[model samples]
Structure formats: C-alpha cells, structure tokens
Target: MRIRDTGDLWWKNAVIYCLDVETFMDWDDDGIGDFGGLVQRIDHLADLGVTCLWLMPFYPTADLDDGYDIKDFLGVDPRLGDVSDFVELIRTARDRGIRVIADLVVNHTSDQHPWFKAARRSKDSPYRDFYVWRADEPPPTHDEVMFPDEEQGIWTYDEQAGEWYRHRFYRHQPDLNTANPQVRDAIAKSIGYWMQLGLSGFRVDAVPYFVSGTADDHADGLDDPHDLLRELRGFLGRRRGDAILMGEVNVPYEEQRRYFGVETRTGDEDDVQGPVGQELTLQLDFNAMQYLFLSLARQDVAPLVDTLRARPAIPRDTQWATFLRSHDELTLDRLTDEERQEIFAAFGPEPHMQIFDRGLRRRLPPMLDGDPRRLRNAYSLLFALPGTPVLFYGEEIGMGENLDVPGRLSVRTPMQWTAERNAGFSRAQPRRLVAPPPDGGYAPEHVNVADQRRDPDSMYTFMQMLIRRYRECPELGWGEVEILEQPEPSVLAMRSTWQDASMVTLHNIGPEATTVTLELDDIPADTRLVDLLQNGEQVIGKDGKVEVTLDSYGYRWLRISRPESRRLL
Candidate 1:
C-alpha cells in the first residue's frame, strides 16, 4: 500500500524527545522546572536532532496526580509557570525547528477542580453530573480502581451528596462523564484553546477509560466510548484542521484496534470504524513498545519479531511512537504471569534484578549492574527499530533509575546538567530536594554531555553518530522493513528498503564472536557492502559466499548496492 501524503508535516522523519519540563530545567531556582526554564533548553534539544518535543502535562493541577489531575483546562500550573510561559515555550521550541506536542488529559480532572467541588457540594448542583455519579445503587463493580494499593474501589462514597463517584485512577482524579454532552463540549473548548496558541498536536491520556463499563460489560474497550472520541475529534478538527491526535490506549492488541477507529472485531452493527469521528492520525503502539522492552530484558528476539509481524498495518502517513521507557511507574502489568516468570528466570540470577524490580529503589545502569557495553547494545536496537523513536529524557546520557525516592520519582530525576551539587538540577540544598538527585555514579563528572561530546567512542558520541546517519539516509526513516531469516538465535538481522536503495542491519546479542556468511546468490553478485559504522569498511568479493566476524554485542548497518548501481541514492 502507498503512503498517503496528508501534508501532516511535523512528524515526517522526526525524532521526538520526551521531556518532563518540570524535571528538565530550573532556571528560576524555585526548586521546580518552569516554562521559562524549558524555553532556555530548546537549543539543546535542537542540537540533538530532535524534530518534535512531546512535553508532559503543564496544566493547573493538584500535584496529586502529577499534572494529569487538571483543575483548570485553560491555565498552566503555577508551579510550572503561567499560560504565558507555556505559550513562550511553544514559540521557542518552534523557533528551533522543533514542533511541540502537549499532553491533553481529558479522561479525568482533580477532585479540587471547581467543577468537582461544585458537584460535591450538593446533589442538585448543575455540575453534579459533569463527572460520573452513581446515585442510589452501589458503586459499579466493573469499575475497578487502577491503583488498588491506594484505593479499594473505583467509586468513593460522598457523604455530603449521599452518593458515590467513579474514578478509574486515583480517587482525587475523578473520571469525567464523557457520555454527558456538556463534559464533551467543555473538553473540546479546552483543547481548542491550546490549538489556537500554535500547539502542533496532543498526546491524549488514558483514552480507553473515557467511557465506563456498561451494566453487563466490564471491559475498558471502545464499545461505547467511540461516540465520545468521535465527538471530540469532530470538535477538534473544526477548530484546528490537520492537528494530530495520538491516544494513549494501553490495552491488549485486540482491544487497541478500537482506538484506531475500528470499533469491534466483527463487522456487526456494534463495530465502528475509521477515526472515531474525524480521521485521528495516531495511537501510541504500546503493544510494540512493551514487546521491545521484553525482548531487551529477556535477551530474546523471536517474541519481539513475532509481535511486530502481528501488528495490523498502520496507515502509511501514521506510525507508532516507539520508546524504551517513560515517566510512568514501571509496572510488569504488560507481561503475562508466565512471561514474568521467564524474565525472572533469566535476569533473577543477576543481583541487579533485585534492584530493578524494587519499585524505584535504585539508579538506572547500576541497577543493571552498570555495564556500559550492555547499555550500548540496548540503544543500538532501540535506534534501529522501525518507527518514530522517542528518547526518554537523560537516557542519551545513560541515566539510571533511582528507586530510593518516592512514587514513580526514579525516572523523574532532575537532568544531570553538571557534576556540581545536586547534579546541577537546582540550587536548592540537599535537604530541600523535591526528589533525591541522582547519585555520583551517573553524575556529570562521568556521564555529562559536555564530557561525552568530545570523546569519539563515548555512548553519547555513538548515539550522535547513529542519529546523524539516520538523518543522512532518508530511506532509513520511511523504508519498508524485512526481517532476515537467520539460523542463529543470537543474530538478529533485518533490511530496510526504499525503491532501489537498501540497508542491511545486523545486530549481535551474543557474548562470543560469530561469523555471518551471506550467500552471493541470495543477493546481487556485483553488490558491494559498505559498513556504515566504520566509515566505508568495504567487502569486495562475491563468490556465492561472504563471511564477516561480529564482536560481542556489536551491530552493523551495511549499505548494499551493485557496483553498476553505485549512484543509487
């Protein structure tokens, strides 16, 4: 199938950098990252070859649900900066050739929000129905609480109103009643406000929970919620034509299809198809992302390849948002019990496994036993994958997870700017740290950008070279992927092809050296293989066989072309 030229310009050949602005920079020294602080870092992101900046929520929030618990849709959190700060941040990022995609959490609002407060004050309050309210009956059994450790049920009893309210996430973050037309209209207006300020797109949060479970059905699929999304899409399309909308539908592969506008598996009346309403462009491919992590952690490639092959073909103009990790708590919910057991069996022998699973108690690489070689291999696979790659903040510098801090705070450590006090995150004293700063293990003394920028063999430099190669090769960005059939389990190979140009990508995951022999008959006899990483390491002969040795965890991207077709570009 041919790719549609939607003229949706921002995402094409883009490398999106996921930046938690609050944790990115602290220019004002208020012990928090503000928009003005983020504005100052646009040049850094641009220099890194990032085409889009996916900013986490900057909305007015109670800080309980981070910024997801929006109290005011039109305002930015005072702790983060004002609406003016956000506008300036967007403008500054755009000026640096980086498009901005903000988080739009429409599924829920903070309990302290004016609408929620007014709703709870009295049963007859006009805002009472703005959020889901179970009047006389018991709270819906199917409505399960996402945070079972903190809350027992999805509904909390409101003594003042003599009712129970639904909350799919934390109790303080109540799920909006999307079935209500008023709520839908309000959310649309909020989205429009940002669109008017030159926002490129939105990374829609918790899209599957927009609709509650029906009396007979308890699943969080898009059975009845399609209408809500359809309505939202219609309103947003009218306000801002061609604006991208990517939903965070973290569900099984079967159920995820619904978020892409295919309502049901069967072609029945219940099945809705196409864009939920207007043609929504993309949805976060959690399926692929999860499989990728599993493959890396387990040191297995088959499951990942199987999962990738199983995914339904996406529209050519649209693509998956690939990532290694994100700001959310690292829960093993994506893995099945058997798969978890397998991962444990493989990694459990290592001491690092204890720290890795201890729920934010350890730093990143140290938790993985601080092996830079392993880190390099992980990133090689990440960058070579087929999709829009999103680098979690500080990952390029080899930042580790810090679990000693509280509540999903490990991945949210302040950017290690310099090895100065508190890793140069803030001027605040050690005792006043919002979240404990990263220890000296990965501090600026060793892993800072400044130090690595000068070293040719450093991981930072390696990543820069790889990204530069990706930028140089347009085929690498939009080429078709073909996995090579190889006998060795440790050898994973694939080819990216666009028209006459092709690139053979080979990755060695084994600890021992292995020779890969390519049959000359399988490819063009007159073809020449140029090693991309080695700056023109070439292979000359093609006597129906060509052998090359790969180092432990080494990767190669060979640009292949027939001698006669040397001008292939």
Candidate 2:
C-alpha cells in the first residue's frame, strides 16, 4: 500500500493548460478535432513551459452537456480517436516531462447509458438502484438546482418507469445514486481504468451534489454521504499516494472546507495538514475569482482583502487552482445583486453577454476592451495570487469569443492557430467547424501564435517570460500571505514569505497614478529591493519603508535581498 511517488510536488507550482480535445485541432478532414492532431501538437505545450495538461471530458457521450453527460465511463469517444491514439498522446506528453489530467464526471450520466436504460425498464432490474428514483411525485417546488436557464425543475417524471428521477443539471443527465455500494465500486473501477491508462489524476465535477443526501434521503440502505468521498480518497491513495484529485464545489466559501477534507495523523488532535492526504488535492478558488472581478469593477482592494481574511486554512499538501476563465461562464453567484450589476455594467454591458443572471459569457480580453496595460495588470494579479495558475487555450494570444454562438458555447470556439482557413484550427469548411471562431478584430488574421511569437511585446512572449520567472520563485506557490495596509484604497499590496525567501507585490487597481509607501519592519535595515519583473533596483529607506510612484494600472514585484540573497534562484 505504500507506493512511492516522484515527490516532485509538481502540482503546487505547475502552470496547467486546460483544453477540449475536440476543439483543439483536427488532423483528419472529418471537420472535428482528434488525438492524432493533439499528439503532433504536444511540442507546442512543452515550448510554452506548461507542466500539466487538464483535458475536458472526452468520454463517450450523447451530444449532451458537451460530453459531460458521460454514456461510457471506461471508453474514449470514437469521434476523438481510438484507445491506441490516447495511449500514444499520453506517451508523447510524458516524454517531455508533462502530466495529463482528465475530467471525472461521476455526478450524472446520459439517460441513454446502459445502466440507466436498464434501470428505467423494470423496477426489479439489478441496475434499478444505480440511479435515484422515487415512486411518488417529487415536491412541487425545490431549490438546489443547477442550469436554471435550461432546467425547469430538479426532478422529472418518467412515464416508462411511472416515477420521478432527480437531476442536478440537465434532465438528460440523471444523477447517480452514489450512496449505493455497487455504485461506489463502479466509481473505483473508473479511477483504476484511467490511472492504468497513464493519466495522473482527474478534475472531479459537481462534488457537493455527489454527497447531497441526508440521513433520511437514503432509506434503501446506503452509506453516509461522507463515506463515498473518503472511500474514493483511500482507493486512489492505495494505488498512488501522490495522485491529484481536483474538485469543483460551487458553494459558499466557508462550506468549501468540507470538500477539502482534513488530513491529520491518528491521535495528533490537530486539523493542520500532514503527510496523509484527504478528499481533494486542490479545489478551484471560486470565491477569490468572483471577488477579483468585483475589485476590478470598483477599482478598490477591500473585496480582495476580505476574501483573503475569510479564506479557511487548507491542508499544507492541498492547493487552489486559480484562473481568469475556464470552460464555463465566469460565475458571480456569490456576490450581491447590486455588486453583480455594477460588474455587469463595467465589463459585460451587452445583455446577451450576461447569462442566467449570475455569470458572464465572455472572455477576459474582450471584457477589458483589449487594453494592454490593463491586461498585464489583471493577469499579473492572477499569477501573483496564492495558487497554481491555469490558462485556457488560446488566451496566451488574447483570443476573443463569438457572442452569437449561443450560451456558454460563445467562449468554447476552436483554437486559432494562424491566419488561414478555419483560423488554422481545421481545414474543414466554416459551416462544418465547431463553434464559429472570431471573424473580426480578434480573428486569426489579426491575432495568432504565428504573429505574436515574433513580437517582443505580444502577450505570448510576455507569458513565456512570466512562466520562466514564476518557476524560479517557488515561494509564490507555498508561502504565507500578509496584506499590507496602505492609505490609498485603490492600491493593493501584499508580502509573501516562505522560509528565508521573501517578496512583495504592489498594483494600482484604479485608472489614476498613485504614490504609496509600504512599511516593512521584518526585513533587514541594510536590505535592498531587487525587482523580479525586470524593473530597476532601489534601496530601503531610513524609516524602514519603501516609496514608489506607479502610473495607472502599473505593478511591481520586488524581492527582498541582503546582498548575498539578491540573485534570482
């Protein structure tokens, strides 16, 4: 049971690139992306300094929820490629020291899945218990529903079975009865299957709903809601102790701790992190992401400060996944209506761009109006935060979205490779391609890797430089954060220290120039400030404080160095 790992702790400081295989590239003329194209493009990721690849759901599906409605948990989609192509892709990625992760969508499956189909056919079917079904009509009204834009209710009646089935998301995806023992075994089987196929871990979807039932919710003899998650943790640990399990639990910030399980040694009596790992290795910091948008809109740092203070302590081994955008909409559900409206007015002025009254269906560059200084400032804050940063594909070159593509699909267009047919993503005709690629200013003709790679000031080059600098400073990923108090509310500053290494970052969130002095008593009096982001150097003042003047949206990253410790690692 004590399997040894590389002990690289790679996930902590990793720069993850998330992409959908089907929209990434298409080598065949089938008008869809395939693994053959992905295998050939592994070198591009390696060149970008990517450490991990987070693949969207590629399992067999019924064209529902963009493959999240998994129909076959153990097989790859035939449209993408055969099993051998997946193996070759993983092998190719491994050769460059990159690890791959996939989505584990266990919350629900397509209603057409064999288990669900068989269960709905007869009440006596062995698989009947695999899904949650009620003999009586469900409650007329209920909360705790997702996809309110598309789903009318949480429970839908099934005439064939003469009962109601529960679904947290789309009606086509019926929630699995995770409390059942056989269902738990089936989940374990899925984990083992992918691990054996060379995947490093999985991005667990809808985690809270996985354990939604209460004491009375399971009258058919099932384990407690918490047991299933604990079992999944133990199962993965037995096979590979360093396995990563990233969860997406969209709940209140305080409630997220339950999903990030506590890992403590027996009789230790301490909730602090230890060698033993628990439920989730990393959870997306939705609270911080949502608050950051508020801070951006108001040009104030109070929201960010509050979010930091409210952050519950996590196990030392566990980390957070921070991102500017992902496959789904940018969620603002945690903010108040007034706050949400203010942000909507500032970033998403268009009515159709805002969706479900809780999210923005546009990309970051478009929201910022393609301002280069603001772009650098916004992304600088993202990378400086206390988490592993994730970059959505094509964002390095500042790709925009297609508003007319419908729903969240507006942001899920194919990757723009160059200024060619189909934006160099595929050779297929425009009508047969995936979600339409941007055609105007953000089209491949104007913005793409081929053009940005040669420009020194392009976002692509900036990212390469940023990643190299990030890898040199391990403290950003594992350090303790302390917010520095400043007189100006629009200026944000913080100090991050890990052991003997210490660095300070400052940013002007507003549109006006600002001059602020940060008091520092812990640093040595003789220390000098060496800018890590290629800025000039400056000496500490006699008052034990440093003063700097910043233009609108300007930022600085300075490392505290005492002559002997001034060089970058």
Best by lDDT: 2
Question: Residue pairs in steric clash, candidate 2?
Answer: none
lDDT of 1 at 24: 82
Candidate 1, residue 450: Cα displacement in angstroms equals: 2.9
TM-score of each: 0.88, 0.95
Residue range 1-569, candidate 1, lDDT tens digits:
23334235345457778878788888778778778778877787777778778888888888886678888989888888888888898788878877888888878899989999999998788897787777666744543667655677788888876788888888899888776667777988888888899887788888877855353432443236776676666676787676677777778776766555644446564444332334345666677766655675666677778887877654455556666667775445577867655645543444333332422233335534567766676667766777667777887778766556655666787887776776677787767655666555765566676676677777677777677776655456567888876776677787787666677777776676677765545565556787877755446455755666778877788877666554433
lDDT per model, in order? 0.70, 0.84
lDDT of 2 by residue, 1-569 (tens): 11122145678878889999988888895777889989888888898889899999888899768889999999989989988999999999999988999999888899989999999999999988888887787775445677777877888999898888888888999988898778889999999988999998888887888733434766665645556777888898787766788888778876887676775555453556554446888888999999999999999989988997888877777888988899899999999999999899999988999998899999999899999888888878888888899899988889999998898888888888888888888888888886778878888898888788889989988888787777766678878888899989888898888767788888888999998787887666757877777768667877788887778998888888876664553
C-alpha displacement of 80 in model 1, angstroms? 1.9
Pick the TM-score winner. 2
- Distance from true position, residue 402, model 1, in Å? 1.8
